[model samples]
Target: MSETKISKLFTELNQLKWSVVSKGVIVGLFAGFVVALYRLGIEFATEKSIEIYEFLKHNQEYIIVWIVVIVVVGLLIAWLIKCSPESKGSGIPQVEGVVLMGMKMRSFFIIPVRFIAGILSAFFGVSLGREGPSIQIGACGGDIIASKLSHNKLEENYLITAGASAGLAAAFNAPLSGIIFALEEIHRSFSPNILLAATTAALTADVVSKTIFGLKPVLSYVDIPALPLSQYGWLLLLGILTGVVGALVNKFVLVSSKVYDVLPAWSRPMVALLLALPFGLFLPQVLGGGQNLVQLSETAQMTVGVLFVVFIAKLFFTTSSFGSGIPGGIFMPILSMGAIVGSIFAQTLSGFGIPASSIAILCICSMAGVMAGSVKAPITSILLMAEMTGSLVHLLPVAAVAFIALLTSDLLGIHPIYEVLLERLVDKDHVNKKHDNIVLEIVVEMGSDVAGKKVSEVNWPTGTLIAGIRRGQKEYVPNGDFIIYHGDYLIVLSSEHELETMNTCLNKLCRKN
Candidate 1:
C-alpha cells in the first residue's frame, strides 16, 4: 500500500479507538451514578423492612397492619409485572438475551420499573438480591446513551456490555470480576474492543461505588487465615458437596415456574409474600437476601443443626420466591446457602478435630464453589468471592473447589442458570414474532452439524442468506467453495415470514453433532 493510504488508515483507526474510549467513559459515569443510587435505595428498603418486622414483633396489635402491608406490596409487584413483563425476575437473563440474540428492550420503562419493583419486593421480605436489578439499570443507561449518541448497532453492543460490567462493579465493588464476567460470560470472546470498554467502565464504576459506600468490601471477613496444604483434601470434599447441592438448586429453580404456573397471574407473587409472613415472624434470619445469615455463619454463632435448618429454609424459600416471577436475583441467596453448607461441613469435621479457623476457610471456599457450579462462571465466581472478602490468600483453594463444582455440574448435564433462563425468555417472547428483516448471529460449536462443511454441502434454511462469517478479528463473505469452521460466528439474515423457522434451523445447525 502507498504511504499516504497507510497513514490515512491508521488515522481513522486511532480516531475510532479514541471514540470508543470516550463513549466508555460516558457510559461508566452515567451507569455508576445510577447503580450507586440503586444501592442506596436497596439499603434503605432492607433496613426499613427489618424495622417493620421488629415493630410488629413488639406490638401484637400491629400484626394485622403488617399483613395488610405485605398484601399491598404483593399487589404492587404483581401490577409492575403486568405492566412491564420484561422487568420480571433477575434481569441478567434479559440483558444476555439482548446482547446475544437480536432482542430489544424498552429501556425507558424497564429502568424505573425494575428499580421500583426490586426495592418493593425486597422491602416486603422477599428472598431477592439487588445486584441483578442494578445490572439491568446500568445496561439500560448504556443503551439509552448509545441510542442517542451512536448510530451503529455494533457500537451500541459494546456500550451495553460496558454498562453491564460497570453496573456489577458498582453493585459489589469488584471491578475485575465485572470486566471478566462481561468478557467471559456475556460476550463469550476476548475481543480487544470489548476488553477496553469493559475495563474502563468497571474501574470507573468501582470508583463511584467506593466514593459512596466507602472502601470496605461488601462482605468483609477480617483476618482470614490461609489453609494448610494438609487440609486441601477437605476443600475437594466440600466442592463435591457444593456441586451436588448447586445442581439441585438449579433444578429446583428451573421447575419453580412450573410449580406456580397453576396459579392466577396476579396471585403468583402474592403467594410468596403470604408464605413470607410465617418465616418473617418465626425465622427472620432467612429473610431478604440472607446477608445476615452469612454473617451468622461466618461468626459461628449458629449450631450445626440450626445452620442446616436455615439452609433448607433458604433453599426452599428462594426457589419459591424466584419462581413467582418477582424482580430479584439468586446471586446473594446462593452464596448464603453455600456459606451454610460450608458451616455444616466444618461442624461435621470439628467432631474429628478440625480447627475452627480451617472451617472458616472452607466457608469462604464453598461459597466460590457453589457459585461456580450453579452459574458456570468459575473465574467470575472466584474473583467475586475473593474481592468481596478483600483477600486473595485462598486463591488456590478457591480455584480447586470452583473447578470441581463446575465439573460436577457439567457431568450432570446441567446448563448454566442464566443460559437456561435466557432460553425460556426467548421461547416465550420471540418464538411467534415476525420481523421485516432480521439478522441472527450463531457461534459454530465444536462438532456442530455444519462444522467442516462447505457452503454448498450444508442444507441451510430457505429464505435465509449468509451475510458474513467472523473468524478471530476478520470478517469474510462466504462463497459456494468456502468451508465453515467451528468457532466461526455466522451472520444470517432472514425475512419476517421465515424468522422463527430460520432461528430453529440455525440453532440445530449450531448444536454439537
Candidate 2:
C-alpha cells in the first residue's frame, strides 16, 4: 500500500504484460510464415487451375477430362471436410467459438486439412477468399504454441487472437486493420493486453508477408482523388444501396446454407463444383476469389450491363460455394461483389454530369460501405479500404459511407454476416463442449439495448456472472449501481451448460432494438 510498493507492483505488471506480448510476437512470426506459405500455395494452385481452364477452352476434346478433374476435386474436398469438420467454411466462426465460447479445435488436424482443402477449393474455381483460411491457419499455429508452452487458458486465448490478427494482416498486408479487427470484431473489447498482443502479432506477420509479396497494398488504386463536398449527397445514396445489397447478401448466404443442408454432406460440394463448371467455361471472370474481377472493374474493362451480370454470378456462386460447407472464405468474394456494385452505381450516374474520376471515387467508397454493412465493423472496413487502396485522402467520405451503410443494415435488422454464421455453427454444436467454464467478452455497441443501462437494469441470464467491465483504459468491478455505456466491454462468466441460454439473453440485451 506504500508509494514505493505500488510503483514496484506497477513495474512488475508492465514487465509481465510485455513478456506476454513478446510471446505473441513469436507466435505471430510462426503464424505469419505458415500463412505466407498458404497464400503461395493457393496462388500456385489458382494459376494452374486457370491454365487448365484456358487449355480446355481451346481444346474441347479435353472437356470431359476437365469434368472428371472437377468431380474428383470436389470429392477430395468433401472427404477433407469429413475427415476434419472443424476445417469447414471460412474458419472465422470456429475461431470466434474458440476465443469466446470455449470451443476447442484440433490444431494438428485442422491446420493441414484447411490448408490443403482451401487450396483445392480455390484451384477448382470456388468463389472463396484466402483471408479466412489464413486466419484459421494462424490461429492454429498460435494454439499449437500455446499448448506446448502455456497452460493458462487466458494467455492461450490471447495467443490465438494474436495468430488470427497475424493471419489477416499477412493475408491482406494490412496490419492496422488486422489489429483493429481482432479487437473490434473478434475480441469485441479494448483490453490493453489484447491490443498489445494483437498489435505485435499483426506487425510481425505483416513484415513476413511483405518480405515475400512486396510492400504494395493488396488492391492498389493510386491517385484516388478526394471527393468534393458537393458530391457528398451521391456518396450517401451509394451507402444506402450497399446497405440493402449487403442485407440481401446476408440473407442469401444463410438461405443457401439451408438449401444445401437437405443434400447429403458429401454431395453438397459435388453439386456446387458442378455448378461452377458452366461459369468456368463461359464466364471465368467471376471465378475463384474474383480479385482480378475487381481490378478489371476498377480499370473500366466492363460496362454497366456486364458488371451487373458478373455481380449476380459472383454473388450466387459465392453463396453456393460457402453454403456447400467447403474450406473457403467470403471476405474477398464479398469485397469483389461490392466492387461490382460500385462500378454499376458509378456507371448509372455517369450521365448525370459526374466525371469519370468521380465515378472511380464512388466505386472505391462503396466497397467500404458494403463491407461495413455486411461485416458490421465500420472501423475495420474503413481502415481496410484505406490500407488496400493505399490512400487516406478519402477517409472522410469512406467513413461517412461506412457509417451510413452500417446504420441502414441495422435498421433492416440484419445481423452481421459473421455473427449469423457463428450462430449457425454454434447451434450445430461444432464446438467442443468439454470445457465447462466459459468466459465471454461482449462489447456494447453505440445503439445496443444495454448501452445506457445500469448493471441491474438489464435482464441478465440467471447463471451468468459479470466478472468485470472494461471501459477504455479503466477497469471496474461492476456493482448494481454501476452504469454501463456504449463501448464498455462486459466480461461474463458462465458454465457450458448455460452458454446457449446466456447467449440468447445477451443477444437480446446487446443487439440494437
Candidate 3:
C-alpha cells in the first residue's frame, strides 16, 4: 500500500513479465524450425508441379495425364476435408477462435497435413496462397509450445501470438510486418508483453527461414519509383476505383459461397472442375499465384486489355476456389488481382501521355490501394507492399491511395476478409447470444495431465465447473457427465476468489489428469 511497497511490487511484476518473454523466445525458436521446413516443402512442391505442367503442355499424350493430375489433386483435398474437417479454408479463423473464443484445437496432425495437402493443391494448379496456411501452421507451433512449456494462461497466449508471427515472417521473409500483423490483426491488442513475445517469434522465424532460403524478398527487383507531384491526382483516382472493385469482389465471393452451399455436397467439386477448365485454357497467367503477372506489371509490359482480362479471370477463379470452400487463402490472389487492375489503370494514363516512369509509380500505389481496400488494414497493407517490393520510394503515393481506398471501402460497408470469415464460421444463432458478464478462458497444454482426460472424470476445484466447451466450430454446454477433450476450450465462470482457487485447482488437476 505504501509508495515503496508499490514500487517493489511493480518491479517484481516487471521481472515476471520479462521471464515469460524469455520463455517465449525459446518457443519461437522451436516454432521457427517447423515454419522453415513448411516453407521449404511449399517451394519444393511448387517446383515439381511446374515441371509436370511444362511436360504436359508440350506432349499431347500427356494431356490426359494432366487431367488425371488435376482431378487427383481435387479429390485429395476433398478427401482430406472429409476425413479431418479442421483442414478447411485459411487457418486464420480457427487460430482466431483459439485465441479469442476459447476454442481448443491442436495442430499436431492438422499442421503437417495442411502443409502437405496445401502444397499439393497449389502445386497441382489449385488456385491458393501459401502464406495463409503457412501462418496458421506456424501459429499451431506456438500453440503447441504454449501448451507444452507452461500452464500459465498469459504465458500460453503470448507463445501462441509469437508462433503465429513467426510463421508469417518465415513465409514472406518480412519479420516486421509479421510482428505488426500479430499485434494489429491476430492479438488485436498491444502491450509490452505481447510486443516482446511477438517480436521474438517473428524475428526468430525470419532468421530461420532466411538461413534456409537466403535473405531475399519474396518478390524480386521491383523498381518502385516516386511519382511526379502531378501524378498524385491519378493515384487518388486509382484508389477510388480499387475501393469499388474491392466491394464488388466481396459481394461476388459471398454470393458464390451461398450458391455453392445450395448445391449438393458431391456436386460442388464438379462445379470447381468446370470453372478451372475454361479458365485454365484461356488465361493461364491468371492461374496459381499470378507471380508472372506481377513481374509483367513491374516491367510495364502488359497491355491494358491483357491486364483487364487477367484481372477478371483472377477474380472469377478466386471467388470459385474460396467460395466453394477450398482449403486455401486469398492473400496472394487478392493482391495479385489488385496488381493487375492497378496495371491497367496505370496503362490508361500512359495512353493519355503520362510518362512511363510516372505510370510505373502509379501502378505500385494502385496495388497497395486495392489491397488496403480489400483487407481493411491500411497500414499493414502499405508496409507489406513496401516490404514485398523492397522499395520505400513510393511511400507517399502508396499512403495517399491506401488512405482513400480504406476510407472508401469503409463507407461502402466492407469489413476485413478475416473478420468476415470468423463471423461466418460461427453459427448465426451463437452470434446473437449475450455473454455480457460470464466467462473464463484457459489454455491447456500437453504435459497437463488433463491433456487427454474427460471433463466428467476430472475433479474440478471448489466453486468452479465447466459450463461449455468450444473446439473449432463445435460448442457445447457441458453437463456434469461430459468429458473434456484435448484442444477443447473449457468456459468456466466464478467469482474473483473462487476463480483464484479454481485456477490453482485446475493447475493441480492438470498435473494429475
Candidate 4:
C-alpha cells in the first residue's frame, strides 16, 4: 500500500479504542450477570443467617443443632476451597497474580467455587463482604472469554482487567469506582488500552446490575446536607483518626492470619465458623458483612457508645472471619468500620455544637477515607464513595478526607493491604507454568528507577524483549536511544520459565526502589 493509505489504516486503529470495547462489553455481559447473581446470593444467604440467629437466640435447645450445621458448612467450604485453592481469601490478590504477575487462574474452577464458597460463608454469618469474591469471579469470567476470543495474551489480560472493573461495579453498583479501582488498585496504572476496556466493562456491568436492583443508591443517604466550610477542620481530624485506625486494622488482619497459620488450612474456616456462633446469638448487629450496622448509623439508630462497642466487636470479628482464609472481602467490613467511627466522631463533637445535618455526610466520607488508607487507592475510594452515595455533592470534602487519610497511612509505612496479600500469596503458592511465548504489559510508574532513563540505559533481563511502547493514543517501536517516560505501557515478550524472574526484575526497575 502507498504511504497515504498506510497512514489512513493506522489512523483507523486510533488508540486501539474500538478493538477493546466490544471485548469489554462481552466481558461485562458475562461478569455483570454473574456478579449480580453473586451479590443476590450473598444477600439472600445473609438474610437467612439473620433469621437463623434470631431463632437460636430464642430457642436455646436448638443451639447445638445450629452448631452442628455450622461445622458441616465449614467443612463444605473447606472442601470447596480444596477443590480450587485459588478461591481463598478475598481473591483480589489472586486476580493481581494473574494480571500483574503473569500467573494463572482457572476460571472454570474458580467461578463456581467462589460463588458457592462465598454464599456459604455469608450464610453462616461470616463478617466478610461479597465484593472481593465478586471481583475475582468477574476477572475469571473475563479471562475465560478472552482466552477464546483474543489473539494474544496481552489482550486477554486487558479483558481480565475489564472483568474486574465490572465485578466491582456490579457488586457495589458503582461503575466509575469499578473502573478506577481496576486501574488504580488492580493494574496500578492507567494505560489507554486499559482505560478503554475498563470503562466499557464497568458501565455495562452497572447497567445490568441496575436492571436487576433498580435505580437506587447502594446505601440511602439522600438529601444529607454537606458539612460547612467551618467544619473542614473536623474532616482533617477525621482523616487522621481513620487513617491511623485503618492501618491498625490492616495490621490486625495480617496478625490474625498469622495466628491461624498454626492450623491446617482446611480447619481454619471451622474455627472462624465457631467464632461466628457466639456473635450470631449475642451481637447479631455486628454479624455478617455489617451492612445493617452501616444502615443503622446512616439512619442514626445507634448512639456513640453503642457504635463504639459494636465497632470493636465487628473489628475483631472481621479479622478472624477474613483471616482464616475464608472466601469473602474486606470492602464492606472496612467501610462499615469507617462509618461507625465517623458516627462516633460526629456524636462526640455534637456537644460542641456541630450540626446533626453533617452526621451522615461525615459517615459517608469516612467510609472513603478508611478504604483509601487501607487499600492505597485514594482516587478509587473517593469515586467509590461518590458513586455509592449517588452524588458528586460531597466529592470536595470526601476527596479532602481520602487524601489526608492516604497520606497518613503512607507516613506510617503501611503498604496497601492487597499488595501485602499478593506478596504472601507469592511466597506460599508460586506456581510456574510452561508457555512457549507470552506477552505481558507492564506500565512504567512515576518516580520509578527507569522513568527518566533511555531504553539503552536500563538493564533488561537476559531473555526479555521490549516489543513495543504504548503512550496514550500513540504506539511506537522503540530503538535503544528512545527515552521511556513514566505512564508508558510496555509490551514485553518472554517465556514461562523466565516470566517470574523477569517480572521481579521489571517491577524493581519500574517501581521506586
Candidate 5:
C-alpha cells in the first residue's frame, strides 16, 4: 500500500465518520423534542381517560349514558382507522414494515393522528398500551428527518433507529434500555454507528423528558429483600411456566384476531364493546393499561384472589380489544398482566414451604419470561424490565426466565407477534389495492424459457430488473449476459404495473409465485 493510497483511505474514513456524527447529532436533538411532545400527549390523554373513567364510575345509574360513551369511543377509533388505516394496531409492525419492506411510503400524517387516537382509545378504557404507539410516532419523526437529509440507505436506517430509541426512552424514562430496545429488538445489529446514534437519541430524549417531569423510575420500588440462593430452582421453574404462559398468550391473541376477521366489519367494534362492558361490572381495573395493577404488584399490595382475577380479566380484555382492530398498544398491559400472574404463581408456591420473598422473586422472573417469549426479544425484554423496575440485581433470574420462555415459544412454533400482524396487514392491503406493487421471488426451472435464455433475450418490463440471482449457492449482481440456469433464484424489483406486463413473459421463461 502506497502512502498516497493510505492517506486517501484515511481521508475518506474521516469524512464518513464526521458525516455520521453530524447526522446523529441533528437527529438526536430533533428526536428529543419529538419524544418530549409525545410524552406530554400521552400524559394528557391518560388524564382525560382517568377523568372519563371516574365519571362513568359515579354515573353507573344511567346505563344509557355509559353505552353512549362506549359507542362514542368505538366510533372515534373507527373514524381514525377509516381516515388513516395505518393508525390502526400497535404501530410497531408498521414501523418495522417501513424499515424492512423497502417501501418508502411515509405517512407523515399518521404521527399526530395516532397520538390523538391512541390517547382517546386508552383514556376511554380500551385495553391497550402506549409504548408501541410511541415507537411508531418516534420512528415517524426520524423518517421525516431522514427523508429531508441527503443520505444513503444505511445512514437512513441509523437515523430511524435513533428516533425509535428516543421514543421508548421518553415513554419509560429508561435511556439505556431504550438504546437496547432499538438494537436488540428492531435492528438486530450492533455496530459503532448504531451504538452512537441510539445512545445519543435515548439520552437526549431522557434529558428533555426529565426537564418536564422529574427523573423517576416508571415503577417505583419498595425495599424488598432479595431471594436466597436456594431459590434458584424456583426461579427456573417460574421461567418455564412463564414460557408456556407467554406462548399461550401469543397463540390466543393471534387466534382471537383471526376470529374477529371472520365477523362482519361493523360488528367488530360492537363485540369489543360488549367484551369490555363486563369489565365495568366486575373488573374495572382490567379495562385500561393496568398501571394501577402494576403499582400494586410492585408494592405487594395485591391479594392472591385479586391478582388472579386481574390477570384473567386483563388477558381476556387485552386480547379482545387488540384483536378487534382498535388502534392501541399492548406493551404495558402485558407487563402488568404478567406481573399479576407471576405474583399469583409465587404466592401459591409459597404454601409449599418456599419463602414469600422467594415467591415474589419467581413472580418477577416470570414476568420477564412471559414478556420475552411474547415479544420474542429476550435481551430487550430483560433490560427494559430491569430499567423500568430499577432492579438490575435480578438480571440473572430475569435472563434465565427470558431464555427459557423464548425457547419454549420457539418450540411451540409461534411466530413473532409483529411479523404475523404485518403479514395480515400487508395481505389485506394487497387485496384492497389489487394494483399495488409487490416484491416477487422467481426461480428458473429446468424446462422454463429463461433456463437457457440470457437476461438480454427475455422481454423484461420497464422499471423492473433482475436485481440479483443466486446460482449454485453464489449470489451475484445480474447483468445483461448473466447466464440464467436451472435452480437459479432471481429477485425481481418491480411495480405491479410493470409486473402485469411481464407476468406472462416471465412465466414462460421461469417459475413465479
Candidate 6:
C-alpha cells in the first residue's frame, strides 16, 4: 500500500471509467426495479392490514381467529430470521459492516428473507419502515451483479455504493438526496469517480420509480405559506425541542434491542407480534412505520394531547418492532414522530400571531431537524427535506433548524443512530480479528494541526504510515523534513482493523477545526 502502488491502482481505474460507470448504470437499473417492486409490495400489505383491522373491529367473534393467525405469522417471521440472520433488524448496519468492517453479506439470502418477512411484518401492523429493507436488497443484489461484471473488488465496492444510492432514490423518489446520502452517510468520501457513479445511478433509479409511481413527493402536506423572517425565533425553539427528542429516541432504540436480547432468537419476533396485537385493536393508526399516523396528522382534527399519545404509542411500537429483530428501519417512523412534534408545537403556539397558513410548514422543518439530530447527517437531512417536498422555498428555515438541532445533539454527546448500531455489531469481533492493509486518502485543511508542520514534527497514529503526498500536479514521497501544506492529499496506509483508530487520529490532525 505505497504511494506508487496506490497510484497504479487508481490509474487502472481511471483508464476504465466507462466500464465502471456503465456497471454503475447497470446496478442502478437493477436496484430501481427491485426496490420499486419492494415498495409496491409494502404499500399493498399496509392497505390490506388496515382493511383487515377494520373488519375485525366489526366481527367480534372472529377476533380470536385473527389473533391465532398473528401468532402463526410471528412464528413464521422467526423462522425467516433463522434462515437468514443477517436479514434481521435494519440492514444498513450489516451493509456498513460489509463495506467498512470486512463483514460478510449474503447477497442472495437477504433479498428474499427481507422481502417476505418485511411484508409479513407490515401486514401484521409492525411500526417499521421499508427504506432500510430496500437499501439492503439493493446493496446485496447490487453486490451480486457487480461481482459478476466487475474485474476488481474496488470496482465492486463502487458499484455497490451506486446501487445503495439507487435504492434510497427509488424508495423516496429523491435523486439528489440519495446521492448525498451515499457520499455523506455511506461512503464518507468525496472522490470524483464515486460522485460520478452515484449521481448517474441515483438519477436513473429515480426515473424508474417515478415512471411507476408518478412524479409526486413521497410525503405531502396541505399547501402552506413559507415562514416569515420575523418567525425565526420559533424555528430556533423547534430545533432544540426536536434535537432533545431525537437524541432520546436513539437511546430508546438501543435499549429496546438490548431488552430483546434476553429472549431466545426464535421467540423474539413472537413477543413483538403479541405486543402489536393490542395496538392493532385500538391504535392501528400508530402502526406500520407511522404512515397511517402521518396521514391522520395531515387530514384529521387533532389536539396536542392526542398527538402526544400518538407519539408515545408510535415510539413504543417502533422500538418493539425493530427490537424484535424485524427487517425494517426507523427512517419513516422518525419523520412521522417529528411531524407529530411539529404539529403539537404549532398548535400550542396558536396565540403567537403566526399565520394560519404557516402552521403546516413547521412539520417539514422539524423533520429536517430531527433527522439531523438522529442521523447526524445534516447535509443529507437538508437535501432530503428539499427533494422530498419538491420545494426550495423552505430551504433556509430547514437548514437553520437542522444545524441548530445537530449542534444541540452534539452538545449532549449523543452519537448518530447508525454509528451506534455499527459499533455494537463490530465490537464483538473487533477485539482479536486482524484485517488487510487499506489505504485512505485524506485532505489537509487550513485549520488542521498538520497544515503548516513538517512531517516529522507531527505525531502520527500508531500502526499507520504516510504513504505519499500529492500537491497540485506533483507527487512527493513524504520525508521527515517534508512540509504538509493546506489542500494537500495525504495518502496513509493502515490495517483494516485499525481504521477506526486511524480515522479518529487523522480527523483531529487533517480535518478542519
Give the number of the best model, judged by lDDT: 4
Tens-digit lDDT track for model 1 on 31-57? Answer: 899999988888788778787777777
lDDT of 4 by residue, 74-128 (tens): 8989998888888899999989888777777888999889888888888889999
Model 4 misses residue 388 by how many Å? 1.4
* lDDT for each residue of candidate 6 in 1-513, tens digit (9 for 90 to 100): 666786775566455456667777788888999999999999898878887888888887888887788778888999998788778888877776665554667778889998899988878778889887777787876688877886665566667778888889999998898888888877765655667778888888898999999988888666667888888889989999989988978988999999998898788888897888788879888878775566556443688899999989988888888888888889889888888888888888878865556656788888888889998989988998888677889999989989999999999999989888888877644222225455566678787899999999998888878877878756677789999998887867667778767866886788776
* Higher-lDDT candidate of 2 and 5: 2
Q: What residue pairs clash in candidate 5, if any at all? A: 49-123, 129-329, 450-509
| C-alpha lDDT (0 to 100) for residue 340 of candidate 1 | 90
Name the top TM-score candidate.
4
lDDT, candidate 3, 391-462, per-residue tens: 787787888888898888999999887778777776532221112222354545456766666666666677
Model 4 residue pairs with clashes: none
**Which stretches of model 3 miss by more than 4 angstroms?**
1-16, 264-274, 428-513
Higher-ranked by TM-score: 2 or 4: 4
lDDT of 5 by residue, 8-88 (tens): 533442354456566666666676677567667666665565566566667777657767776777776677677777777
Candidates, ranked, TM-score? 4, 6, 2, 1, 5, 3
Candidate 2: worst-modelled 10 consecutive residues by lDDT: 5-14
lDDT digits (tens) for residues 131-150 of candidate 2: 98888888888889888877
Model 3: colliding residue pairs: 104-487, 147-445, 449-513, 454-484, 455-483, 455-484
Q: State every prediction's TM-score relative to the real structure.
A: 0.89, 0.90, 0.79, 0.94, 0.79, 0.91
Error of 4 at 454 (Å): 2.4
**How does model 2 score by TM-score?**
0.90
lDDT of 2 at 69: 82
Pick the winner on TM-score between candidates 1 and 5: 1
lDDT for 32 in candidate 3 is 75
Ranked candidates, highest lDDT first: 4, 2, 1, 6, 5, 3
Which regions of candidate 2 fall more than 4 Å away from where they truly are? 1-16, 434-460, 463-513
**Residue 330 of candidate 6: its Cα lDDT?**
90
Please give the TM-score that candidate 4 achieves against the real structure.
0.94
